[model samples]
Target: MDKTFTYQELQKYNGKDGNPAYVSYKGTVYDVTESDLWKNGRHQNLHDAGDDMSLLIDQAPHGVEVFERELVKEVGKLV
Candidate 1:
C-alpha cells in the first residue's frame, strides 16, 4: 500500500483545533478531530475512537483525524 500521511503532517492535523485529516480504514470514514481525538496524534484503540465506534477499523495504520462538518469545535487548547 502507498503511504498517505507523515509524522509532520499528522502532527499539524491532529493535536490542533483545525482541519482534521481524513483517514480511510476498512472503506469507512471516521469523524476524528481535535475535539474528540488528539489534534496531531495517532491513536489506535477503541478508547480514542469515541465509544469503540468501529467506524474506523482496518489493517491501515491508525486513521488520520479528518475535519468533519458535524464535528465542529472552537480553536482553543486541547481539552
Candidate 2:
C-alpha cells in the first residue's frame, strides 16, 4: 500500500542532512532525490523539497506532464 504522510511528516524528508528529497503534487508525494534538477533539495533555486508543489506547478513553464514522465518516482500520498 502507498504510504500516507501529513504535511508535518513530509517535512522530515527534506533532502537535507542525509534525508531523502520529496515533493508533493495533487496529494501525491514524489521522490526527487535522483534528479539533478533537485540537487540539495532545491529545484533551480526556485522550489524546495518537502513542499506541496501543487500550487507552484501552475507557475512553472512546464505542465503537470512533467510528473508523469520518468523524471520522478511516485512514493506516497500526502494527507
lDDT of 1 by residue, 9-53 (tens): 333543334456433333233435534444443454323322222
Off by over 4 Å in 2: none
- Candidate with top TM-score is 2
Prediction 1 global C-alpha lDDT? 0.38
TM-score of 2: 0.93
Score every model by TM-score.
0.27, 0.93
User: What overall lDDT goes with each candidate model?
Assistant: 0.38, 0.90
Clash pairs (backbone) in predicted model 1? 14-39, 14-40, 15-39, 15-40, 16-39, 20-66, 20-67, 21-65, 21-66
lDDT of 1 at 38: 42
What is the Å distance of residue 16 in model 1 from its true position? 6.3
